[model samples]
Target: MPYFKPFKMIILGFDGVLGSVLSGALDLFSFTGVSWQRFSNESVEPRFNVQIASLGGGDIRCSNRLIMQAHCDIRDVTECDLLLVPTIGDSIDKVLKQNSELLPHLVRLANTKADIASNCSGAFFLAKAGLLDHKIATTHWAMPISLRQIFHWWTYKKISL
Candidate 1:
């Protein structure tokens, strides 16, 4: 098999989910590429090609009024070597009710062997696609009980954020 060069890291974003984790990872690593994407209402919006230009400057606001910014989109993700899903909110019920279309694409991406990483409540998306079944995972401590209650077959570990 031919070895492919590692290119950009793609960060998936919703309206409220922050993109800092993805951006920080890029800054910490010597990646040849990095980018982000917003998957809104069953459609994907490709943003700018990520350069050092997009970091340490802007702010993006989360649904909970948290501010964050300075991230690129998936169109900038060519030959993606890593993908990050940042923590969103605690309401899994609300996310499913609102972002139902997000899962099928997530499942498709996972099936294609994308290196999927999630933090905090981002696990909810994985769970929705049945990806967390029989796998060890972590989430915010306050929500583990509810997560376990909903995903009975999966083990949820409490982790400090």
Candidate 2:
């Protein structure tokens, strides 16, 4: 068998992360490989390899109260092509407080060669990690304007630069 490197994409898992977003993205990426070819009656290889990672490297509960056993933890992942942040379940402040420990891991991952992307409230984590500094970004539609102000206030120097 020929060994070809596939694009590695890691999805960040957290306590309040929406299960749908995580599973939805996982399923979408899963379909990209040879499975799509079989599903479509054509021959094609998957371009991406996906994995779900959490802080403790264990099962995580979503905002909808679903338990998801992550494939691994942030500590287990040395590097990847991309890191995807999913939607958060609660108020921005609450979620950020609950996930404060994730900042360092996210920061380390962001500093790597891997690209970082997020959906909805997930952008907060990326921003808190300093990945969004000086980058144009947006968050979940439901987020209030005040949240943006708070973020701007917190990272005033970085964003201004």
Q: Provide the clashing-pair count of each candidate structure.
A: 7, 1
- Which segments of model 1 are wrong by more than 4 Å? 1-4, 19-61, 64-79, 157-161
Score candidate 2 by TM-score against the native.
0.85
Distance (Å) between predicted and true CA of 52, model 2? Answer: 0.5
Candidate of highest TM-score: 2
Quote the lDDT for 127 in model 1. 86
Writing each residue's lDDT as its tens digit, candidate 1 over 19-114 gives 455445445444222222222342332222233212223444456665555455333333444556667753568755566655666666676656
Residue pairs with backbone overlap in model 2: 33-46
Per-model TM-score versus the true fold: 0.60, 0.85
Question: Taking the tens digit of each residue's C-alpha lDDT, what string does model 2 give over 12-45?
Answer: 9888888899999888876766785688896566
lDDT, model 2, position 82:
87
Q: Give lDDT: candidate 1, residue 83.
A: 57
